[model samples]
Structure formats: structure tokens, C-alpha cells
Target: MPELYERIAERFGELILNCPPDRWEDPSPCPGWTAWDVVAHVISNHRRAIAGLDGSGYSAPGRGEDLPRAWDAASEAIKAALRDPVKARTLLGEEFGSMPFEEFVRRMACADTLIHGWDLARATGQDEGLDSEAVAVATEILLPEDRDIRMPQAFGAKVPSAADADARTRLLNFLGRQV
Candidate 1:
């Protein structure tokens, strides 16, 4: 079976490709951010992670108002980095810092992409679907025992807990998202 991170990366990419350009103008679940803004955030994350892999410092240059262009730039940079052979395996901070290059890439880029995919869907009034295997992997990766709670404080609210929820729900909740 493919690793969870790989599956998530694939699913996230699919979500991005399928997003309707018209809906990019709509507001998403993320407060004060439009669908385009969310996409920009995801793409920016990809760019930063790829930069880390390339031995360059991560950069999250804020995109003031032109979020669509920001998204396009970040996305293209990340896509190019994905084709590179470098691996970023250092732990600069508490997030996925200690993970392997590929795993770090997935946890940071792919999982966020999955969540933002939901944000975009909500903004666009479309169905939200995460790759089941990817969610499961993320759930395991973000278990409370292994979780660093501080990270979500900087990103967004953690995923809310659900009784009898599957791995996906648990993972989403752990990440401070409401599923």
C-alpha cells in the first residue's frame, strides 16, 4: 500500500486541480480568508517545505490582497520542488520537524491541503471529501500522545473531538478542525 503521506499529497493535488476558479472569490471556513486565500496558504506551505528540502530557509511571504496570484506562484514553486531529489529531514520546530523529508512534506503540505480542501469546498458549497487512507495516517501521526499542541495555535483551531469517530474524524479533531 502507498504511504499515508503520499496518498494525502495526491488527494490534495486533486482537490486543487478540481477547484473552480469562480469559487475562489468566496469566503471559506477560515475566518476573513476567501477560497483563493486558503489556496494561497496551502500553496505557500508547499513552497516553504520545498525550500526546506532544497536547503534554503523557509519563506512565507505574506500575500496582501492578490491571493490568487500568490496561490499560483506558490503552487508552481512547490510543484517544481516536488520533482527535485532533495529531502528535508531536520526538526527546526515542534511540528513535523523531526520527520523524514517525504513525511515532513506530507504532514506539512498534504495534510494542510486536505483540510483547506474542505475549507474551499465549504466556501464553494461543494462536497468535502478527504482521502480515507491519508486521514488515517494523519490520525496516527497526530495522536494526542505524539501531538505537539502548540502548533495548531499558530495555524488554526485544532480538530474537534467526535465520539465513535473514525481515524479521519480523530485526525481532523487533533488538528483542531471541525469535521
Candidate 2:
């Protein structure tokens, strides 16, 4: 799972690097957030994960017009944290109370990274489709039997999809995306 997280993080970084500067202000599936905002949010989340895993304090980076650089720094921090097996087993607090660091990386960090990678690609007109393995893992972790019960609060209502919708589409719908 750590290796998987690393791969997902690398893919997300690639997507961020490929995003055109002109499209940074374009709206994304996330309500009221621009493509740049999506990247910023992912970077922020990565910081939170790093803080939780390593007991380091998080200071939000200045994303503004320097989103790519900020993302690169955050990505490097997250990858570095994940490389330490001893630190990866540390118990985190709050929402991650006592959860192993590696588990948090798999369940929260990696999942968010992959999903937002898709969101960033879609927002920038770079929707070449999500990786199949990542989509499968996201679906399994994020969409449990009681997902509908919690969907409205976290993601709003599930958007309807065609009967033949692929796993990626289904995963998007589950995340309150219209794709």
C-alpha cells in the first residue's frame, strides 16, 4: 500500500505539472473551486497527513500563483515521510486516533491524491481517464455498504450514472461528481 501511495502521489504530481497556466482559474467538479484550488486542496491535505504521521506542525504554504511549486514541496514531504517505516507505524491523533501511519497513508492520503488527480485532469481538459487499479482501490475504500448514509454530508447526493458506466464513472458518481 505504501508503494501504491507513492505511485499515486507521483501520478498526481505529473498531472499538476501538466496543468496549463492559463487553465488554473477554470472551475472544477468541486463546487466553487478552480483547478488551482483543487491542487491547493490536495497539497493542504498532504500537509495534514504529514503532520499526523510525523508529529510535525503544519503551516499552510502560499499557493496563490505558485501552486506547482507548492505542490512539489508538499509532495516531496509526503513521499519522504512515507519512506520511514518506523515513523509510518506511529499513532496519529484526531480523526486518525491511534491508527497506524501507513494505514492513514493508504486509506486517506493515497485515496485523496488519486481522486483529486482525476478532478484536476478533468478540470484542465486533460481527462485521459484514471488508472484502473487506483479507481478500484478508491471504490473499495471510499464506497462501502453504508456510503449512501454518509454521502450527503461529505459529498452530497450521488449523481446518477448510466447502467454501463465504468468503474471510474461509478467512483466519480459516488464522490458526487456528474461524470
Candidate 3:
């Protein structure tokens, strides 16, 4: 079975490789974030999570509330950090002490990569689809948490109870995003 973490990383790499720098500045689905801003946030997340994987409480540098520059710098930093052992880890975990590094990485990366991909696609008018494993992993990770119902920002949308529904849509809905 393909590891969801690796799949998520591959998707991130694909986005970086395929998305143009000009597209980075475009607006995203996120209410206030541009495509570049989302990229920055994703990069920062990878960097920080990798730090935690290394057993260091990695902290993301302030984006300074400046969207464009912050996004650009964060993208650059994430790419750069992947080359360092201290910043890159094959394994990952959460800072909130919620779950194992592997499990946390699966859910976090899936949510970030898939949702942000949607944001980027919406902004650039590109086709955005998540990997099947990512969708499945995200759905499985979310179903029992009840966090989706408790936290409006994280998970507020209603997930369909249909058994034959698409996993990606289910994950998105579970995360409170309208598909």
C-alpha cells in the first residue's frame, strides 16, 4: 500500500512543479488567502511538522501578515528545508499531541494538500483532484473524531451519508468545506 504521507508529499511536489509563479499570486478559495498565501501556509506546515518529526518543536516563522511576500518566502523555505535532515523527516506528527506522527501526518497532509489544491485550482481555473488514498485516509481519520462537529473552523459542513459517494467530497464535507 502506498503511504498516504508519501502520496501527500508527491502531490505537494507536483503542485510546486506544475504551478507557475504568476499563478501563485492569484486569489484562492480561502476567504482571505491568495494562491501564493496558501502555498506559503502549506510550506510552513510541512516545515514545522517535519521539525516535530525530528523531535524538535519546530515553529513556523511569522509570515508577518503580508500575504504575497510571505507566501513566496514560505514556498522557498519549504523547498529548501526538505534538503536538511533537521527540517525534513520521512515521518511526521502533530504539535498538539493528538496522535502518532504517522497518523497525524496522514490527516494533516491530506487536508492541507487536497484543500489547498482546490483553492489553487479555483483561483487559476485549473482542474483539481486529490489522490484516492488521500481522500480515503482523510475520511477515515475524520469520521470518529467528532472534531468536525465540535470545531466549526475545522469541520462544520455536513458530510453525506451516502455509501457510494466520492471519498474526496466526503473528506471535504467532513472538513466543513462545501464541495
Candidate 4:
């Protein structure tokens, strides 16, 4: 799972670097959010995970031309935090009460990174599909029985996909993305 986190982070870094400057303002699948806003949202989630691990509040740095550098720094910080077994084991929030550190990293941090990586990729016209392993892991961890209830708030209503859709397409459709 730690490896998965690293892979997702690396892929996201690539997507960020590959994004054209002019496309930052392009609209994404996330309602009104732009491509840049999707990146910011990913950064925010990483900051929140770090804060949860350390019991410290985290805020995103101001958006600027140096956003890539800032994002890389935040991404590295998150990877580093996940590497520390002791810190990773610390219980930090109510939603994840009693869940072990590694589980939280796998289910929360990595899942968000994977999903949002797809979001950013799609927004930037870089959609080349997602890692199959990551999709499988996400399907197991993120898609709970009550997902139908919770997803509508964070994602659009589920879009239809082929009966034999691939894992990536299934994930995207399940998350309310019309891939």
C-alpha cells in the first residue's frame, strides 16, 4: 500500500508537470473546479492527512507560478509521513477511529491521491487510464456498502459504463465520472 501511495504520487507529479499553463483554468469534472483547483484540492487532502497524523493543522500555500514546486514539496512530505511506521500508527480522527496507521494511509491518503490523479489527468487531457492495481485496491477500500449514499455529495451521480468495462472505467463511472 505504501508502494501504491508512492506510485500514485509520482504519477500525479507527472500529470502536474505535464499540465500546460494555459489549461490551469480549464474546467474539470469536479463541477466548477478548474484543473488547478483539482491540484489544489489534492494538495489540501495531503495536508489534511499530514495534520491528522501529527495533530497539527495544515494549510495550503498560496497559489502562484511556483505551484509545481509547492506541490512536489507537499507530496514529498506526505510520502515521508507515511514512511514513518510509528507516526503512521497514531490515531488521529473520529472517522478513522481505531484504524491502524497503515490502513489509514492505504484507504484514505492513497485512495484520494489515486482518484484525484485521475481527475487531474482527465481535466488536462492526459487521460491514459489508471493503474489496474490501484483501481483494484481503491475498489476494495473506498467503495463501501454505503458508498451510494456518500458518493453523491462528493461526486456526481453514477454514470453508466459497459457491462464489461475495465477496472479504470468502472472506477470512474462508479465515482460519477463519465470516462
Against the true structure, whose TM-score is highest?
4
Count clashes in each candidate, considering only residues at least 3 apart in sequence or on different chains. 9, 0, 1, 0
Off by over 4 Å in 4: 95-98, 148-153
TM-score of 2: 0.88
> Model 1: which ten-residue window has the lowest total lDDT?
87-96
Clashes of 3: 1
Please provide, for model 4 over 58-132, each residue's C-alpha lDDT reduced to its tens digit, 9 standing for 90 to 100.
Answer: 776567646688678877877787788787677767855566666776875546778878888888889656778
Task: lDDT winner between 1 and 4, please give it.
Answer: 4
RMSD of 1: 4.4
Please provide TM-scores, in order, for all candidate models, with all chains considered together.
0.66, 0.88, 0.66, 0.89
Q: After superposition, how far is residue 99 of candidate 1 from its true place, in Å?
A: 4.3
Per-residue lDDT tens digits for candidate 1, residues 102-160, read 56656665457777777777787677777776666555555654444545323455656
Candidate 2 residue-wise lDDT, 118-165, digit = tens: 888889988547778878887887777445435432465778889999
Give candidates' CA RMSD values in order. 4.4, 2.2, 5.3, 2.0
In angstroms, how far off is 121's CA in candidate 3? 2.8
Off by over 4 Å in 1: 1-6, 57-99, 145-147, 150-162
Candidate 3: what lDDT?
0.59
